[model samples]
Target: MLILGAFNLFVGRLYLIPSESMEPTLNGCAGCDGDRIFVNKLAYLGDSSPHPGDVVVFRGPDSWNGSYTSQRSRNDVIRGIQNAASVVGIIAPDENTLVKRVVATGGQTVQCRAGDPGIMVNGKKVDDEFTEKPMSNPVDPATGSQACQGPYFGPVTVPQDNLWVMGDNRTNSLDSRGHMGDELQGTVPVENVVGRVEAIVLPFGRTGFVDNPDIQHN
Candidate 1:
């Protein structure tokens, strides 16, 4: 058990999906059991870095705090226990961690405009097959794209060492797009990434490796 705990703490860990933000790609809901996923902490070690289309777990930037609620116990004793359990992957750590897909990396420019079929990175339309099917949200009249919902934004260049991220669920996700007013233009620092989500490991019926396609090419 001690060895397993150490491994979980430093190598990889299991995390439970708590919301539908990444829906269709990762199953999560309010009341039922969410999909359990394995995050590979070693994925970006050495010279590797997250790339566009890779789903990752990361610490939310300061601008995102308003949307998060901590799950730590108020009592010292219980909180300590929870902390210990989290080390072993028994429960999620009490932190503002979020999961989303990388939309554009450093030096790339991303945007959505009127009549665009999907998001554009470096002026090329990204393939939208991975996004939620039959998008139900009211399309943004300004952008005319269901992907943008109501906020058509950016040709904004991603800062060096930062990442532009968004959820596959688009309309339902309060991802980088929603925090564009911040200093980093809603981009997450590469340093804040906890790990790359590699696979779904729980809820037997949905177990499988998560896809990380080259979204910028299409």
Candidate 2:
């Protein structure tokens, strides 16, 4: 029985939010900085629903890659220890594990235009109450970034079976709009999501249940 219990412990796991991809909720790095969030590794057991604005944790496809890839986080030593499985993409992330806002799921279109003031879902602006900023940054395909400079894109439709994701820090975030939803580059599949991020469990100032509750997808 102890062996079964131990096996269950490793089969399921917990993680802390360590980045700003999810903000104003889950405190993925409070103040846009810090590590704190705990996930129920088995939360997807039933027919669960992943709503828009819910901070979600997922294992990106073997092909879905990050531009700023690192096997370890410079901010924490535990990050190095916990991520010891870097070589195999297991314990250390090997570039997997992403914390992002569920902007649109299944069949929906998400649009954000500079000077437009908000994100539009199916032509209607999504309630931007919980977001730290509007989703209106442009991506440069050549450089695979929006921070270098903008003047990018518009009217992007999130395809079926894929979930459109983004970071709350619009200007500095690399999300769905990064490369025309760059295949193997951007855009997360529904199958990739494991569970919704529910709270910050470390750094006393940023611990509690996540709060981005106004998200409504069309």
Candidate 3:
């Protein structure tokens, strides 16, 4: 078991989708059980980087709910077990390490507008056909007023070596768009990426290769 665990940790690992952040594309949404996915750690062993539309597993920044740091808040033995279990995909390394889809890579501009197929990258509309609902902000259902208002996020360019990521369930996901004011300005550094999700590995009914969206920059 240890050997298999180590191999998985260094080469490929499995992850259980614990939230609805990537719903409709990767499951784990409200009232639905999550999917287990295979993450290929060697995917970028040749110094490759994440591409737009690839679902990736990564260690989020400090401001991303302190997922890594939270371990420090746990009992030593429990934390140790969690870490060991993570080697074989028993649980996530921490709550902060997450799975999200890359929306824009370095040097690209991305924005979310108030309309159908709401996301645009590098001035080109992404073919977002996987989502069940059109992108819309949370609003007061009674009056239809936006629950919160601002500059409407992005229209900002991703910095070199950084990536703009989001969930397939756009409206409910707190992704790069929600982290705009952080130290990384809502973009995750390329170095933080762990690997790309290759396929669903559990619940036989949902096992399959994850589809990469057709993202164009015009």
Enumerate residue pairs that collide in model 1.
Answer: none
Q: Identify the candidate with maximal lDDT.
A: 1
Q: Which regions in candidate 2 have their CA more than 4 angstroms from the true location?
A: 1-12, 26-33, 66-95, 133-152, 212-214
lDDT of 3: 0.76
Provide the global lDDT of candidate 1 against the true structure: 0.88
Per-residue CA lDDT of model 2 for 40-79, tens digit only, reads 5555556766777777777765555645476556757767
User: Which has the greatest TM-score?
Assistant: 1
| Residue 1 displacement (Å), model 2 | 12
At residue 35, give the lDDT of candidate 3.
94
Error of 1 at 8 (Å): 1.3
Candidate 2, overall lDDT?
0.61
lDDT of 1 by residue, 27-58 (tens): 89899899999999999999899999999999
What TM-score do all the candidates reach, one by one? 0.95, 0.68, 0.82
Q: Which of the predicted structures, 1 or 3, would earn the higher lDDT when compared with the native? A: 1
- Top-down lDDT ranking: 1, 3, 2
